[model samples]
Target: MRRNPLGRTGIEVSEFCLGTMTFGSQTPEDEAHAQMDRALEAGINFLDCAEMYPVNPVRAETVGLSEEIVGTWVARAGRRDAWVVATKHSGEGMRHVRGGAPITPDTIPVAVEGSLRRLKIDCIDLYQFHWPNRGSYHFRKNWRYDPSGQDRVETLAHMEDTLGALAREVERGTIRAFGLSNETAWGTAQWLRVAEAAGGPRAASIQNEYSLLARMADTDLAELCVNEDVGFLPFSPLAAGLLTGKYQGGAIPPGSRRSHVENLGGRITPRVFGAVAACHEVAGRFGLDPVQMALAWAARRPFVASAIFGATRLAQLEHALGAAEVVLSDELLAALDEVHRAHPMPY
Candidate 1:
């Protein structure tokens, strides 16, 4: 695994970040620990989690279970320094956490302390807002997304307020860097601008859904990240297994997330299968595993700092790690780009 700089925070992490969303949900603690051990063995020092993780249903009782699981591992292993631990403060719409409250200046301290206690760590390597309180266009909300209702003054005030709070956490030595998720380029710029002006943590990275099927980041978002030195941490780089062809022929594999979830993780696009077929065909022409190719394509993006991948099973995690060494050539990338052009905005 290759180490990449995590924005300008001076933190270097493996390009492959192990996502632990299923740590205490679909996966047992022992299995999750084993996966973490294997990840460390494979040179993956970065791990991504959220306070609202282990997310099959994200119930109130299970809200911090994922962090607790990782905390237990951290305590037992006593190797907290060996990993770049990243976690998030849940934003609006999460009723289980702080009554679905939006991220505000006042919520930062409570949230940070909770995460630190649950993770058994004095400081977090990267702390992120799960989503903006003002709302975001991500997660298939783009079709109905409208910014006309937003109050510019109120939004900028929120940005500055939150930045001040985040900087306080940094000063308190509770967080090393601040990041965003499910944010837009314009929103990102404002955060950067606010930090630059008021003296706070600049947005170090963004965690969003980017994959072969979702190429919204390829244009403006890509440019902003590359120029601003903000890292792109893409989750669901495989299109939630669509690019792997496991959902091909309209067949859901046994024990897959699709078999249980009604909406299959909120990816309900009519052109999805067509897009997957196109990608699989390209991978076949290149004689590459569709899974590895999908991951490698996402990880090799110019603005990507790390690609976050989750798994319910050890075998699945191992398969994803195999992409670490599978480098895509220029021709392969160009062919993939053609595939993207052919089936753009699948979701």
Candidate 2:
């Protein structure tokens, strides 16, 4: 696997990051362990997790179970030093985590302590804030998102506090780098501004939902990321398995995401089906697996440092990892671009 520098963090991670959001929910601990072993064997050193994960169903009881599973594997295999481990501190609205407390300088330490205790690691390679406290437009909520009401003073104050906490963690060796998730371009710029002025940690990356079906990152976000050297860690590069053509023609598999959430959180509209079918057609023309084609395309994006994807089964992980070696031709890339242009923002 080719490695890329994760922004200015001086940390090199694999082009493909193994996402562990399904560790305890769709995937059991044994399967998660096997998947980790297989990923490591495939030369994938970037492991991304969170404080509130295993979140397909996202129940109160199952929160943080994914981290525990990864912790067990890290403790048993003793490969903690071999891989770059990234995890997140949950923001408010998830009652199961820190009693739905808002992320602040005080709570930042508490969250880091909890994650360290669970993962049994001395330092998190990348400690990301899982969504902004002010609110985010991610997860299919861009339609109604209103950032106009955001208070700049309060938001910057919070950023300064959290950055101070992260600076302390960096000094204490509890975390090495910092990043963000579900953040807008403006929000990321503000963070960078505060970090530079206060001499705090700059966000090394931003994890968002980006795929052939979701091209929101192609505009301002891409420009900001490139100019600022903020690496892009795109989650759901497969669009929750929609681009793989497994759920084509409205045939939902028994254990698929569609079976749980009928539309996979507003991702399964009529327009989405057409976009997915177009991708499948392109894959056929190129004699490529749709899953591999999508993953490969995502990896080759300009500002994308790493693409994060989770697998519920060993076969799924193997199929996704196979894309690491599959190179897309110019014809395929052009065809994908055409499809993206036609069906941009399908959801």
Candidate 3:
């Protein structure tokens, strides 16, 4: 596996990151453990989790189950220093955590402590904010994303507040780096400016929905990452498995995300299937596996530090890991570009 710098944090992580969002739901603990073992054996050192995980069916009962499962593996394996662990702090609208309160200076220490206790680790390599306190355009909310209603003063003040708290955590050795999820270029720029002036920890990375089906990060965010040296952790590189060609012709497989999420987190639409067909056409035309082709394309993006993927079964994980060796050809790249131009935003 190829290693990439995690921004300027002096930490190197593998090109592929294993996502544990379904650790306790679609995947049991034993399966998740096996997935972790297989991923580590494949040289994937980046592991991503969150405070409020097991997201397939987000219930209060299963809020911290994913972290707990990962914690058990960490304790059982006793190889704490073998991988780079990344987790997130829940933000506003998370009803199960802190009474749906937004992330604040006071909540920072509490969230960090809870995550540390759950993951059974002394320190976190990358601590990310799951979403912005103000609001985010991610997860199919871009249609009604209204930034004009935001209060700039309060937003920047909140950024400064959280940055100071994170800086203290860094000084205390509870966390080594800070990052963001579902953040925009302007928001990330504000964070960088505040960190520079407040003497706080720099924003090391940004995790967002980026893949062949989702190309929102190919413009401003991509340029910002390149210029600022921020690691681009593209989450859901498979588009919730839409690009895998498993859900074609309205045939929903049993135990699949579509069976659980109905719309696959709002990814299912009349046009998205057409786009999927076009992508599969290109994949077939090149004699490549759709799964391997999608993963390889995502991992090779210009500003991508690592492409995050989640697997509910051992076979899924192994198949995704095969992309580490799959290389894309120039003609195939051109064909993909043609498909992208035809169906830019299917959803």
In model 2, how many backbone clashes occur?
0
Q: Put down candidate 2 lDDT per residue, 100-192, tens digits, no spaces.
A: 888989988898998998998999999999999999999889989988998999999999988998999999999999999999999999999
Model 1 residue 190 CA deviation in Å: 0.3
Best-to-worst ranking by lDDT: 3, 2, 1
Ranking by TM-score: 3, 2, 1
lDDT of 3: 0.93
**Candidates' TM-scores?**
0.98, 0.98, 0.99
Task: Give every collision pair in model 3.
Answer: none
Candidate maximizing TM-score: 3
- Candidate 2 TM-score versus the reference: 0.98
In model 2, what is the error at residue 176, expressed in angstroms? 0.3
Model 1 lDDT tens row, 1-347: 89899989999989899999888988889999999999999999999999998886677889999999999999999999999999999988999999998999999999999999999999999999999888999878898999899999999999999999998999989999998999999999999998999889999999999998898998888999999999999998887777778887777777676776746666756788898989888889989988988998899899999999988899988888889988799999999889888888877
- Candidate with top lDDT is 3
Measured with C-alpha atoms, the lDDT of residue 317 in candidate 1 is 86
